[model samples]
Target: MSNITTAPFTYESLSQLTMKEGVLELQVGPAHAGSGHMRILVWVEGDTVVKVDPDIGFVHRGVEKLSEDRLYVKAIPIVERPNLVDTVNANLGYIIALEKLLGLEAPPRAQYIRVITAEISRIISHLYGIAIYGIFMGSSTVFMWALADREPFIDIMEELTGARLTYSHIIPGGVRWDLPKDFGERLEVALKYLEGRVSDYEKIWMNNPVVRARAEGVGILSGAKATELGVVGPNLRASGVKCDVRKCAPYSVYSDFDFDVPTFKEGDSYARLLIRVEEIKQSISILRQALKNIPEGKIIYEDYYKRMTPLMKSIYDEKGRVKFTSLLTSLSPPKGQSFSRVEGGRGEIFFYLISDGTKNPYRFRVVTPSFRNLPYFTHVMPGHKLADVPVIYGSIDYFPPEADRR
Candidate 1:
């Protein structure tokens, strides 16, 4: 390690050094003040990396504080913006946490709706991650194809909720509305289409030599290290850990669905990517199973409406939104804190929600998937060449600044 201050270390000159001493250190900074600009620095002393840093916060929006000011249920759509791709996972985690605190249970059919939306969100979220990974690896065709295929999932969400990205579909007691007529047929078609596209994704990217080269053995995270660092979702599963919330805890109607949590001992970037691909396929199967097992009933919690004020019910009927679900607006509960972890697209989203026998929650905490998976970039990005930084970065599938900087 070189004795240097906070001054910049240019990669242009560092690339000239050739030695068996310590490795190059790569770090990123801002290009301009308030410009949200980014800079990359590297110090190549030898063949081993001694230091690597990722500096973020140029785009910090203070989401936590924003959530604090909003009403209990008002925070749902707001919190989804940071990890917009995994909207349903975010929604599910929040709803489950509230359910634990408020002592509420969604109907079986409503749980099935949640399952369907969550799986669809998983498909789109994986699509976004893979496409971004493809772009980071300089494959525009793969990126375009992956993004284009994500459109069908988005269409499904739009029809179900009248919103493309922010569904606000899940509530404290239950979901907003029941499945539309022919929902089963339409979803089956979408699944068939997704099944074929996933095959093509493997052909062009997963199996491609260049993509595999960039991913395999790039960011090798062992099972022990993954558990120690608290990695979750596909990244942790890649390390051969079969600990899935659905399997271990079996929230909602997950116990009724049949699926496998894919894992690998290699724990490399390629393994993580493959885990997601397999997960998407698995989610489709779960959706099929859920559709088959779905029961007939009210989508929203039956009595939540009866408890609401007449004005609230009138608004609910007029707007067709579940924001006014009684369990949402005037939630008072036993004083306690509960945690709920759900498998998100990036990883597990864990929530710590506290209730104090009042309409407002005493405290709320969320640990997003990217936050837990950021260790890969900080600890694993070094030892690799500058050109491979984006590859490893994408494989981890982080939302950059949003992942860390906490």
Candidate 2:
């Protein structure tokens, strides 16, 4: 048997490994359906996978480095590109870190709006993950259904932020737009529709005997092993670890609402899949609370609100979105460092920012959940069958653009 270490495999070393007897190596694609924008190198003995290495960076965008070159406010959309399905959370994490450095806090109404959009983004991300998993598992029905279900939430976001996917809605002081007059009615309808759809998914997908058999005992990442490997998000929670950034370290207005962090002890592919479903339910609960108790006030911080020119204030009053002043272009923070973490749809999205009293940051670092979860490819796939690769990969919900952004 060949020994595989946690260290990443270089292309040259992998190319030279063909001389080994009894082990066949395979590349599961930068173009494969199951592998999106990345390749997985698999070594198998018969049907059993003996070793696996994930080759990420096919879609690397150098987000951290790019952030250093742009002004603080201009980097919002740049940071959001890595995780298009969960752009709000990515935008929020960066904004929070910038806010900390600037010593700014958004108003109560803005904080509540931030939570509402964030939970909506979480649902969108989870649905995308579930849809991809369905296709991987050969259930085209679930894939279509999950993807179709994301539209209503996307519509709501469009109405609020003027864009569907990469909504640079969250900024340093507050969100870009306030909830629309009819937003509550539309949100309630969407939430109720999703509630019914969740039940359908439970019957057609989650409880399917074939899915259960294929995933229940396969790719078992035990809680201890998951913790040791520094797994985050649903993968970590599925291993029975009660760690969630929202619950453990509340950000925005998360502390104001009540929501449960779903955990499952099984730690198998099935558990990882099931945890996302539960998280969607929790996100729904949070959205309801945020909408119900949202206070009425200026969406941005008072300091920035007061600084808005007469024309900017009138535009905000008429269109319900913030019009940035020239002051934001030259905005600079104190010379210091700050760290911020937010519970994104996948898990914890962390940002470390260093400002040198300049409009652009001195240094910017982001640790995406997908990047943190990459070790699972090496540690968890060793004993599984080669065919089980897609099942485990989908269950982990790894996004290569986000993982490769470093």
Candidate 3:
């Protein structure tokens, strides 16, 4: 085995080794095979990678800067665009921070609904990550099955929020709509079907000898190193660090649900893969609890609910949707700053907002999980073979669009 170094790699350090003997430099892509929307610069000695530097910013939409120009309510869709597979959690993080500055809280029913959709979004994201990982491992069957199973959950989200990928269903004060009349029935069926499919996945993919051979001991990240690197979500938990933003800092009725944060001590590529599977099970458990025990109440805050016009109230009464008033578009909170964080599908999504008591935000900043997890490419790829690059990248479930959203 090649000696693995744990020191941080910077552009200056990488530049210093530019023309070292017996080393070859390679650029992975802004056009990815499976690494998503960023480029990776890899330096290899023989067949082992000696260094890696991720070149991000390909998908930079300047979401934070853009949020400053739009109204608080309008920024929901803008923020959701960065991480389409897990939009609800991103939406939830921003809404929670904005609510703190606005001095508002979502109604109990709205909080519960938010929890339900967030879990559903978590499931959708995990399945997408698993599918992409399967493709990286050359298992077309796993890829297809994982993606096909995602459709049922996507349909459920569309039923509730009226949008497939980017729901933008969450607003500053609360969710945009209440649960559909048949939502419970559809969710039950989908959850049951997915439970059976999980078993099938275990049998065909997780337990397969070929997969185990490839992933079991590859790209190990020790728990200490993981914490030092500030890894989050399944990647952090996979290394046996018992830290989840939801458990550490409960937000939006997450404290009301019963679920376990799964962790594995192996810290290898296989452990990272399995932790996501376990998380899917926990998300399902949360969904069941949220659905069964949800209280009946208005979906928006009382203040926002009271501002509904007669026509809007009638529409909400007849269709269960919350129509926004013009007041929301001109919302200006007190001149103060607030921060909020949520456990997203990939990891902890954090938002910082500064309000100058204007119609638009003074400043908006987001630290996405994928951006936090980006250092893994430099830290974990150095000692592995060139071919193991994709394995390590896929194992971390790094989404480039989310990472590059400056």
Instruction: Flag clash pairs in model 3.
Output: none
Q: Report the lDDT tens digits of candidate 2 across residue range 1-406.
A: 1232223324446555666788898999988887888999998889878778888889888888888999999988899999888999999999999999999999999999989999999999999999999999888999999999999999999988879899898877888888889999999999999999999999989899999988888878779988988999999999999999998899888988888989999888899999999999999999999888999988888988889999999988887789877877788999999999999998899999999998899999999999999978888887778878999999999988899886
For all predictions, the C-alpha RMSD in Å is: 5.8, 3.0, 1.6
**Model 3 CA lDDT for position 341:** 92
What alpha-carbon RMSD in Å does predicted model 3 have with respect to the real structure? 1.6
Clashes of 1: 2
lDDT tens digits by residue: candidate 1, 1-406: 1111222223444344434345545454456221122333444445333334555555556666666566678768766776688889888998898888777788887898999999899889888888888887888998899899899889888998988888988887888866778778988998999899889888878899887766777777778878988888888898888888889888888998879988888887788789889999899999999889889765667778677777767766675445554456655668998889888888788878777766566777777887787666556655665565667667777774445322
lDDT of each: 0.75, 0.89, 0.89
Tens-place lDDT digits, model 3, residues 210-324: 8888888888889998899898889999999999988888998888877898999989899999999999999989999988999998888888878889999898888778887
lDDT of 3 at 145: 98
2 or 3: which has the higher TM-score?
3
Model 2, stretches more than 4 Å misplaced? 1-17
| Poorest stretch of ten by lDDT in candidate 2 | 1-10
Candidate 2 differs from the real structure by a C-alpha RMSD in angstroms, to one decimal, of 3.0
How displaced is residue 344 in candidate 3, in Å? 0.5
- Which wins on TM-score, candidate 1 or candidate 3? 3
Q: Runs in model 3 with CA error above 4 Å?
A: 1-12
Clash count of each predicted structure: 2, 0, 0
The TM-score leader among the candidates is: 3
